[model samples]
Target chain A: MHTNEKTVAKILFIVAVLCGLSALSLADVVAGNGPSPLIIFDGSKDFSTSSVEFGTVYRGPVHFTHGRHINEHAVSCGKCHHDDSGEPINDLEFGDGVDTCTDCHYEETLLRGKALEGMSQEEVIEHYPNAMHELCISCHKEMNNKTHTLSAPEACRSCHGVKK
Target chain B: MQKKNSKNMKNGVSRREFMRFLGLTTGAAAGSLLLQAPGLAAESSGATLPKFKIHTLNSTAEKIYKCKPGIKRFNEANMAFKQVGKEIGQPFFHPLAANLKKNVANSEIGSGIKVDSPDEARMHLAFSMGAGTWNNMFGPYGEGKENQGLLSWNPLYVPKDLAAHPLHDPNAVDLTKKIKQMSRIYGADMTGVAKLNRKWVYSKTCRNMYDASPARTKPMVFSDVKTPRETDGELVIPESVTNAIVFVVGMPRASLQLSPSSTQTMGGTGMGYGRMGLTAVALAEAIRSLGYNAIPCMNDTGLSVPMAIDAGLGQLGRLGYLVTPWFGPHVRIGKVLTDMPLVADRPIDFGVTEYCETCGICARECPSGAISADRERSYTPPASAGSCSNPGALKWHVDGKKCLRWWMESGNGCSRCMDVCPYTRMTWTDNYDGNPDPDKFWDLNLAPFGYQSVKY
Candidate 1:
């Protein structure tokens, strides 16, 4: 009876470890080497997670839900994560060590107005803020319009805290 | 007049026919004619002149200066000066009245008291003295009362022969360039031509601050007159004067950074006003030399912010000042109204509206809480603020009474809003830490005339 109980206990411990691993994998899938569940997009050069680490910021750092977009929204990884040929990487999975958005869209400042006047749409998306804003804002706007509810934020103040 | 007639003949359009087409015979078609006259004049000039290089970072003229759907143009009589003067029972003829009173009350050797140190007082006096020298010598209104100074409506020193035979450049494009170049040579840091918006022009000039008597105010009229004249009952600006050459004179950045009670701050503000007078007078004289009827103005004839916006100098910020991309609010505006045909510049929008929407630094940092901190803009001023604000335009209405009261109590003008603005720094790389040390100002090398070179 004692031997049978020990064997059952070992099996239960394995199952619990497996469940924890699955949860971590799901969280890591969209984290992109940053903090899990929530990612702070602050355009830091040294990849500092703290928003206050920077000297001055034009706007408040965007607090993005990484896990919620993946698990709740059921959004495909390929929708935002893409390869060099501008093609989505459909096979991207957990612990894949994906590149950050700023790694490719590397401009320090967001160029708008006359600066983007003559540039092609593809060229204009290369700026860091442009790329992120286009992806996030467009999706949020689409979701809001489709649902006929403001579940998603579409205005500047909704995403970034008012700077004082 | 003869040159204009000859040019009209060369363009194959008779003056009478052109006038008829313009509906100028009615003498009531000022605004619409003024709007359409530039393009018509350019077409008659008979040359496809190269477009002037756009100097601004971005221009969206159509999007700016549009009153909200239900709003109307603001009346000039309700402007801050007139309103404040009525409340205080004193004619607020000049901006320096409060500062002068403070000087006498404090019994300070200089124009402003230095609560911090003697260096601050000396710096304030040095800048104020320079500015006062120019502003006092030239008429504050730039009306050239009795042809006394350089701000004269009529050319003071230009030869009579030159004034009689105006330059007959039918090509407005070339003329526009020439006028802009002349303006720069005459000490304008930035120059732009904009077709005058009639709504900005005052319906009547306030002759006396508190008096509503007919003799105390003069109607600003557009008439068949060939030149701008100040008659006993009216200030007649000719209908031919359709364009305004607006320019900017930037103040010293170092001095402005020390604001909200510092004498050094007053120094910078004083210097900017002084330079504005000098530039406006010089540019007006140059325009007159070209045989055009030019009236130099420094904050007197019409509102400067709207005219500057129309001229593409800058956008209006929450502080109720022209926040230029180059100099931010640390600049003074000057203008010359003329009949000279010139291509008007499109107004610019360089993200000031968007940035100001999110950033309420100026309001938060304001010593008197004069600036509005509301997230949305409104057409009406706050009820508690009273009639100091002219409330027809859509904007963040600042409380002029509260602002002036602070100025009086502080013993000098406060520019806390101007100093704390993000645009004032023109970059987000450096953190601003309140007023900088005034003692260090004497140690740093500065540009000639105490202005900073354009950084961005």
Candidate 2:
């Protein structure tokens, strides 16, 4: 009778340990930081996951293809995502939460022409639209020059829409 | 084109040489420079220039206006006062009253009794009536009464909660941009900001013509008040109001083409006035919504032309009207004075001074001979201009009394000067006279809002 009781107790203890291990693994997957969180890198199909939409107050929203830049164009995450001091964030993995472009460069209006006449480089980059424009257009222009073709969109209508 | 170029070259002024003389080498730059220095190429080629003399030193108003040192702000009553047998009657209002019989006769002809078709008369009445809607709703004079109309000086629609906490953005640059964007959305064709020049503000409101009492006219005073307020004696503007947001609304070119014809041309003028009132009121309301004090004005409270010029909207033309780069003299000015901090735009020189000097089409086309044909600008107005002429600045002054008399005789307003100005064409086309056929006007599909976009 004693031996049977001991055998039952031993089996119950083994079952409890297995359940504890499974709960921890489930928590990891739900957190989105685990390798199990599958991020589809298809630009056309999974637009919500593959592209970042920037909503503007006075103009049309811009849709930037994250998947296409990473998978097809071979652009690393460090190219755009930067730290508070403007140092690139290298080794950025899938599902890593990042600050939006406007989070730091947060002026509501575009600053250019005479407005930017006396502003320093740092001050100029503080304007939301101006900074985004400088970043995207400069890169696109450089790419076009390198390839010797107008492949990458550089003009305002290419990103914002044709109406403006 | 080739023959003209060769002819120019024979005069030792090649196309490239002409461009170089204008301080540019490229075609685009030269074309732009031509606006600033017209007739220079002709001068080089020894062609006969216009009789008028140009202010060669500068293209600014300071150069053009030969002002007397102690020039005081003119009284509005002296110019616009309307009394039964007064020598100086209000240009727009008195003419309408004086020409009742002539107007009725003109209306009969316009209604197709004299003329075969009623198309011209119908369109004229429709445009005039439709265009006057906004101006009538909001007073043309910008009375600045509290909660009276859309052009009220006080806040109209700001909620209690929002008013309690005004916009806290410290960045004036961003605010200016937002205001400019809002102005365009509100219906302004062009927008500019300028530091308020107190000299432009009227010293006193025009008195009620029918009133026999002396108290009818109210003094306009700037005081250390929180907001603009009106009293029985005065219209008080706060000294804190430091900036003016000027707006320009373009008049329809098609309607303006029917110049001496009062029916069509008056309709165009009315349309500009109506749009100006609407834009000014809406913009003023918008600024108030953001917890800023604003005073909306249209053809009142201040001189719009000088304020508009200061705001970088345009330069003053010889016809005593604001000529914009986009619309020339075919625009009505509206303004809103506010306490909100903004970056003022710098005044621009697009060559209006030089161009107006040689282009005397406006002066020559005046049916009443109201416009001056003098070669030089003077501090004194022409003797026939009457007391309505404010003569402190040196520029060609129109004979207002004669001009008003013509309106009475014609049974409607006349815009002959506006019609014939070369700037109205906005191109290098010479001998371009717009022949307005009222019969064919209805059949043509005009652009929405009566304005057509001009692409460079």
Candidate 3:
């Protein structure tokens, strides 16, 4: 999705305030710099893996194990990541093309019924929340079916903690 | 309109919309101001300071040496002296001899000779503190013979009780200007005067430095002494010593460039301190020769950075080093406490506060992760990080303990922050001139509107 530089800076700033800069790590955190934070994406709270144009508010942290999936599960990079064209993204470097769901699939960009049906596969994924649901649930379903596993947390409460 | 509103309201409100409701936009609006909050908060509060003070005599603005209360001595409160007396770790420059032992054949670079290889030179610079000084650098440190030299100096015990010169003008600011000129000639790149800050003085000697009759050599309780007096091992500054002259000496920039790495080029930092020792000794003697009592100091009395900042040498940078406009963090500090009535210089603003907020080059390159990357400065240091960081100052604090650990890990110390400091190196985006020709590269040389080109 298209995002400007100013928007990017605001996102990083908000995240720094959220992270609670301690006297020791304040320099490393607040500056939004030092040994590439992307190297730690599920990166820093400020500099998100997906979004920059619009900021993020969180209920709880989402634990994504991309490294584990690659090394242990023998997952291919293209299985999850791709360009808007719906083509597999092969040569993903350290901080290659990545975006948040809302960046492209904001409410305005979402599609349904005739609109959803007429669009190409890549175009359909641009529908944001819908795209996130389809991608996650489908992958989980496939994984569960293959492994014959139970308790994969099919509902929102299963993955996201319900605030008391 | 209702239908469109309903369409957008599919899932409560958007995160962006919610943030707007939370009033975080105010935070966004104050971004630039917030970036400056760290440095400015303490600076603006200068006038309200009580026990601590800001001497803005001849400077552009108030000086920034917020201090601990009461008169102190040279050795007792200084961490460097404690490091030496405690013998917990090797002397900071202990590795220099070994570095020189493994030195390569001497080579020629322009007029100077490179007795050590590039790696060895770098290693030496990184490890070149060299047991500090026999006098413990700042003032009296140890007892007996160790307290000989400047440490044993007392204005009362002058070699020849020379009568005060009849022409000695205590009120003349020209005395300070002359001292500044001599300081530059004697190796200081920049110099300023401030009323002696007792709060910044050391509370006592790390070791008893009493070189007196045993009758007068009993150590007083740390709580007992108020104004400085003869108190056994604990050295004290007399009330007569009313003013202080602090100076900044340049480091070899080319040597610092190979920092965080051992290249035998690291000798620059050590060499800078060494030069400071010489400069302080000579300058102090000159001040004393003018019939004013003077005590030279280099890293021994109290914290030099605060004194340097108070003396208007530079502002504190993000990495917690003084960021001089001319030399950046690539300079050593020296001080001379005397009774001479020199006009205190006003503090300076070099835009380092704002610059370091955005520029984290030092923190980013710091191998030890000692430097903070936080955009805003903190008033205190993290607990249990390192002994090197004695927090409580209102500025960006580094994990000096971590930095020292890295120095050990690297078989020497690392100065990666200074290496990457934007002010240290001269580039298209950086400051002017080169590291050599100290007069051209040092902050003292920068913005010397009224001063002439230094003849040296």
For each candidate, what's the DockQ? 0.01, 0.00, 0.01
Clashes by residue pair, model 2: B66-B394
Q: lDDT per residue, candidate 2, A1-164, as tens digits?
A: 14643343232121110000011121122233444222111111211110111112124577899998888878887788889988889889989888888888988676522345568978888888788877886676566445433345543433553121
- TM-score of candidate 3's A chain against the true A chain: 0.47
| Segments of candidate 1 deviating more than 4 angstroms | A1-164, B1-63, B68-77, B90-123, B141-149, B209-215, B427-433, B453-456
Candidate 2 second chain TM: 0.78
**Stretches > 4 Å off in candidate 3:** A1-164, B1-152, B155-159, B163-168, B208-231, B263-266, B386-388, B427-456
Residue B393: error of model 2 in Å?
A: 1.0
lDDT of 1 by residue, B307-400 (tens): 8888877788877788765456767788889898888876765556655656666665555456766555667686546755666676777886
Residue A60 lDDT, candidate 3, scale 0-100: 34
Cα lDDT tens digits, model 2, B48-113, are: 333221112223333345456676665555452232114322223323332322333354312112
TM-score of each: 0.59, 0.59, 0.50
The per-prediction CA RMSD against the true structure, in angstroms, equals 25.8, 37.6, 25.9
**Could you tell me how far off, in angstroms, the CA of residue B6 lies in candidate 2 after the best superposition?**
71
Residues A1-164, candidate 1, lDDT per residue (tens digit)? 24643443232121110000011211122222323222111111121122211112226787888698889888888888889988988787788898888877987665532255468877778788788877886686466435423345443433654343
TM-score (C-alpha) between model 2 and the true structure: 0.59
Task: Give the C-alpha miss distance for residue B342 in model 3, angstroms.
Answer: 0.7
